[model samples]
Target chain A: MSFKAAVLVFPGSNCDRDCKVAVERSTGGHVDMVWHQDTALPSGLDLIVVPGGFSYGDYLRCGAMASLSPVMAEVVKAAERGVNVIGICNGFQILCESGLLPGALMRNNTLKYICKPIELKVENHNTAFTQGFTPGKSVWMTQGNADGNFVADADTLNAIEGNGQVVFRYVENPNGSANDIAGLMNERGNVLGMMPHPDRAFEAELGSDDGAILFRSLMERVAA
Target chain B: MKAKVHVFLKPGVLDVQGKAVEGALNGLSTVQGWANVSHVRVGKVLEFDVAATTAEEAKAQVKDMCDKLLANTVIESYTIEVA
Candidate 1:
């Protein structure tokens, strides 16, 4: 089985091409670039990606406007059926805005646009996304803005932990999330929403290649 | 009919974004430290103008809308009242 993925693109989504390149490289050129205006996702796709960049120019809030785009309607349907979905950076914001993922990613505590490579801890190793890595190791994190810390109620937080939904955690609490949460998975474990850009660290030249393991894991699951 | 929906992050929810905003405002002197802004809570008040003839009907439909979309009970809690 070939690994099929679609990278969603929006008006201000600067990282679309880069994300498409990374996914294509990872999946051996089996990735499709889908526009945000499209009404439906290609059928029987194995994975869908909402990539990074200041979509809608961060107008009302990051991902707030893009959440209402016609394409998200398709994404929500794809996710509900257990099709693997990944949201990175502003994509994470859009997922939250679209209610595919729980809680909201608010502005950073420092109120400054943060762009750098930080450390990440592989918190959950059971999902289709993070199982390729060692259960507890620090990886590299790249890209984010002021509104990046993830917040949810105690019950929702408990549910996430109880269900093994916390996928990745910031080792140093880079965005000040309550539990240093950098990424999460839905209850079904099919939908992954993360603030860091794994695409940025997928290549050896960028610094660390820890992020490649994520794509490798997804591929392994697809091939199985 | 006019309806008001008061939305708030649920109790026991950590408002990290709001806490940081409070701190920043304190630093900028918009509020005194630990006094004027001991804690900052953020929420939205959604006002709706409905065409329902009766207040009860508007309230019921508005409540459904609140439950279906406007509020996320997992992270956000909301109250709906008709005017």
Candidate 2:
């Protein structure tokens, strides 16, 4: 079966191209651009990506506005149907704002937007998204903002921990995120959201090819 | 008529930014007799007014506005008062 994927493009999304390139280059297949206004996604999409950027200029709050777009309603429904959904950076923000994932990304505890390469450890490799890499390995973070801390209630945190829904955790806990959480998954394990942009580091062209393994992992299963 | 709405992260949700601000304040011994304080709570208040005929209408409208736009119901809850 040929793998089909769609990348959502909001008005302020800047990373859609990188995300599409990552998927296309890895799978050697076409990646579709889905606008945030469209009420429906193209049929048979095996995966959907929400790329990072200041969607709606990070207005009201990060991902808060974009989550309400008609496109996200479809995205939420798709995630419900067990479609593989991955949110990166602003995409991660949207997933939280849309209630697809847990917790909220708040301003960094440093009160400054951080843009640097930071190491992150992969906590789980059993999901469709992170299956390509070994669990407990580190990845990279490319940007920062004050509102980047992840927050959730204790019950939600316990549930996430109980189900092993956590995907990535910071070794150094950069943003002071509660429990050092860097990424999350839905209860069903189909939806994954994280702050680091795997798309940004996917190739040697970006000087860090550590990102390729994520897409490669996805393609490996699709091609099998 | 204009009404103001205050939206903030609820009490139990961890306020990292607030803590950062508090940390900075605590670091400043001259600000308010500093050094010993270990915590500070930070929150944002968004003030906006809407045209409504009465207080009850204004309350409902402001609440809806908060739910839909002003406040993120997941991590934050909002309270409104009309004057």
Winning candidate number (TM-score)? 2
Supply DockQ values for each candidate.
0.28, 0.58
- Superposition error at A86 for model 2 (Å): 0.8
| Least accurate 10 contiguous residues by lDDT in model 1 chain B | B30-39
Q: List candidate 1 stretches off by more than 4 Å.
A: A57-61, B1-83
With a 3 Å backbone cut-off (N, CA, C), the pairs that clash in candidate 1 are A106-A147, A107-A146, A107-A147, A108-A146, A108-A147
Residue-level lDDT of model 1, residues B11-83, one tens digit each, is 6666656777777777777344544665687788988799998988998898887765676555677888887
Evaluate residue B47 in candidate 1 and report its C-alpha lDDT on the 0 to 100 scale: 89
lDDT, each prediction: 0.82, 0.82
Q: Report the lDDT tens digits of candidate 2 across residue range A136-157.
A: 5667745545567888878989
C-alpha TM-score for every candidate? 0.80, 0.87
Kindly give the stretch of ten consecutive residues in candidate 1 chain A with the minimal lDDT sum.
A20-29
The lDDT of model 2 is 0.82
Worst 10-residue lDDT window, candidate 2 chain B: B39-48
**Ten consecutive residues with minimal summed lDDT in candidate 2 chain A?**
A137-146
Error of 2 at A64 (Å): 0.7
